[model samples]
Structures are given as structure tokens and as C-alpha cells.
Target: MSEQTAPRTAAGDSTDRPVDRTGGGTGRGSGGTGRGSGGGDVGGPGTVGPEPSTARGEQTRQLILETALRLFRERGYAQTTMRAIAREAGVAVGNAYYYFESKEHLIQGFYRRTHADHVVAAAPALAAETDFAARLRAVLHAGIDVLTPSHAFAATFFKTAAEPTSPLSPFSAQSSEARTEAIRLFEEVLAGSTAKVDPQLRPDLPELLWLGYLGVILYWVHDRSPDQSKTRLLIDGAVPLVDRLVGLSRLRVLRPVTTQVLELIRSLRH
Candidate 1:
């Protein structure tokens, strides 16, 4: 819930990889203030004829998205141009624009797709585990597994995205839908778990877990250890601490501490 909880030095648009989206610029994966560049009609208004078939349109859209991402990864989000994306994808510039409003939108698309894939990856593990900690671990580990493929690009876009105020930041409103979807998955993890947590914490656990996840990600972004081995240790070690902390919530001796913590959490929203 709070990007502030993570080290500011590690930031990027995580398309399953580390990246800086300071701008989510031309090649176009985006954060918040980064709006897909709005433009005029794809072709000069009256110059259109038959549209590409539905299937063809989809393929073209995929090509443009792939090309844009490649360019973003290759040239840095700020340096990649929409025109270059068009040329690389072998589509008209107007056609590319038609599929995507701007570079930022493409970035959002990348995130949305990545999140969708993440959901798929975590499903099996979550379904098989009913224990809160186990499910939580599965979900968290699944995130890293899905991201492993993109490790090489992780740091590239993180620099741009780490900006607190940047729309390209995952915390930005532009990413609300994707962000919420991720939170919801954690919610499911809690729902299926047998962990007897404080009633209020149960509802809020997903968001808290997500915050913890962001912290892990922050570490992961900077983790250069072989196979990012350090991050795996972090997850394995941290989950038990989290599990124990949740277990502590039901103890009467900790009631005052829990109440104060809950109060602090509540105060933040106001």
C-alpha cells in the first residue's frame, strides 16, 4: 500500500523485469502522469478504406505492443520513438497509434498483461494450499518465478518508475486497475487460509501482504546475486516472520500493540 516502505533507490516498471520508466516515454510502457500520447485519427481523416479483419487487427496490435516493448527495453523508455516502433513492427505509424493511444498506454498494457499472467501462475499453488502462510508464500514466490524471465530488464525501467509522483509508478492512479487486481489475489489467499488472525487484520491482510511484497521487490530489483539467490532467501525467511506475526495477533498480551497498530493504519487514510 505504501511505496514509501521500500527503499527509494530501487524503482522500475516491473513487467516481470526491472526497468526505469521515469517517463514510460516513447517506446511506451507507462506509469501515472504518463498518458498514452493522444493523437489525431490513425490515418488522415478521409484516407481510410477497409479496416484489417478482426483477427488481423489483433495480430497487428500484438505486433505493435511487442515492438514497442522491445524498443523500450532496447533504447530506454525515454529514447524509443513511436515512429521507430511503427517501423520495427512493419505497420504504419497511424496504425500503431490506432492500436495504442501513446507510449504510456503501451506500458499499461504490458503491466496488465503481466499481471494477468501472474494470476495464472499463482492459481495452482494457491488452490492447493489452504494454510495462510503457505498460500501466501506460494503467491509471493509465484510472483518472483513469473518475473525471473524478465530479470535482465528489471532495472532498466525501475529508475523512471520509482518516482513517487510519476504516473508510471505502480502506485499511480494509472495503474489502479492492475494494482487492485494484485491486491485482490492476496485477498483470495487470506480467504482460503485457516490462519486465525485478528478479524480486522483478516480483511486488511491482503494489502499488508502486498506492501510486504513491494518491499521484497525493492530488494529484488537491486539483488545482483546469482539467480537472485538472496531474494529467494528473503522470501523464505520473511514469510515465516509474517506468519508468526499474524499468529501473534490473537494473543491478549499483544492486544494493545495491535490496537495501536490498527489505529495508526486507520489514521493514514484520513
Candidate 2:
């Protein structure tokens, strides 16, 4: 099978770090920024006015994230310490802590940024078409478009994500808000369509769909398909199933089950 390949390039933007299969902290000048858009197709912060920072707090935050992502990618996640990231970023450890409550919090930024980029990438495709299935497919494909580029090192990244101590766990305490926000975006995609379903029930559907999507991402991450071909097949096959499931959500019999499932999800959070 032909391997799946994603666009690979330096993540240039606010953060500064290097891109490599092995993770390690690079010396100051050698550190390149993570793919400003690389990472995951999670979601983004809702529309809000820019903060009233007279100075550049956002800029500093970006720098720290970029720096950390580079090192995390170059130096395996565990090997890249907060102190090392601080030193390499030319910021004091305290300063880094001020922006990120913990090292885990810093890693959450990568997921958040990647999710935001996914929204950006999918927008054009979604906007160009009105079919619900097409939009859904575009959204799923957007995830692949963003993730495949980094497949070479993606497995290592996922390995770090699996360790409970590591900060990258999508289910980690640090990632809840970001994860919820990403889930909401997927919900928005569902809501945007003309799919007939109870208005109240539809709101929570995104979280379920996101859970399904994350499963695909997990598969893709560990996928060794020459170029991650298995990952691509998964994307193509799973997304439509999700769409069909979404359509079935309108059935009366599924309503009670859906409610119970959502409650179960909420319970998991607590």
C-alpha cells in the first residue's frame, strides 16, 4: 500500500523550536519553531476581542510554546524539561511558569494551536460546499492534512502523549478546557448543517463525534503505513460512518440512549 504523507515543513510563527524525529533540547540558535500549524486538529478559542495588553503578552506566550514544541519534537517529551526549555528560550524558569502553570500546561498549547490551525485549513473546504457530509468529510480530512506532515515523528509524539506523567494527554487535567473547546468546534460543524435532529440533543453530539475522531487520530499516530497509508484509509472510512451516525441521531429510540451517553461523558469529567 502506498504510504500516506502530510505536508512537512518547519512550524514557523510565534514559537521557536526544531523539527526532528528524536526529541531533545537544542541549543539556543539551533532551536526552530514548531510547525505553527502542526500538531492536532483539535479546535480553537472562540471569537473574542484581543486582550488589552499594552505590551506583547501573546507574543511571549507564543515564543514559549514555539520553543517548547521544537524541543519536545527534537528531544523526546520526557527528555525536554521545563528548565531546559526556559534556558533555551532565554526566559527564566519562573517566567515560563508564569505563562504556563506547569510543563503539562505548556504542552496543551500545542494541541490548542494545532486545533486552531485545523479550523483554518478546513474553512475553505467547508465554505465552498453546503452538503453536510461533504463538510464533515472536509473537517475530518483537515485533521489528516494537518497531522500527516509530521507522521515521521508523529509516533514518538503519541508515545509521549500516552504516558500519564507527560503533559500531552488529551484527557489530562491540563487539556480539559482545550479539549472541550475542540469538541465544541466539531459540534459547531454539526450544528451548521441542515441535519434534522432535536436542537437540545445536537449540542452534545460533537463531543461524541470528537471522541470518535480522536480514536482515528490515535490510530494514525501509531500507524506505520509506509507513509501512513493505513491512517488515510481510516480517515476515509471512519468519517462517513460518523456522518451516518449523526444522521441516525434523529431517531426517537436513540434519543434516550444519547442522553444517557452524554451524562456518562459528563460523569467522566468529574
- CA error at residue 236 for candidate 1, angstroms: 0.5
User: Which runs in model 1 stand beyond 4 Å of their true positions?
Assistant: 1-53
Candidate 2 residue lDDT tens string, 30-80: 243321132221112111112214245466678778888777678765566
Per-model TM-score, in order, reads 0.78, 0.68
* Best of the candidates, lDDT: 1
lDDT of 1 by residue, 1-270 (tens): 011111222223222111223433222233333222342224321111123345656677778888887777677776666667867887545456556655667778887877788889999978798988899888888888887876776676667678787666888898899889989988898888898998757777788888898888888889999999999999999999999999999998897988888888879857
Of candidate 2, the 10-residue stretch with the lowest lDDT total is 40-49
CA error at residue 132 for candidate 1, angstroms: 1.4
lDDT of each: 0.70, 0.63
lDDT measured at residue 109 in model 2 versus the true structure, 0 to 100: 74
Model 2 sits at a Cα RMSD from the real structure of 13.3
Candidate 2 deviant stretches above 4 angstroms: 1-57, 149-153, 163-167, 198-201, 251-270
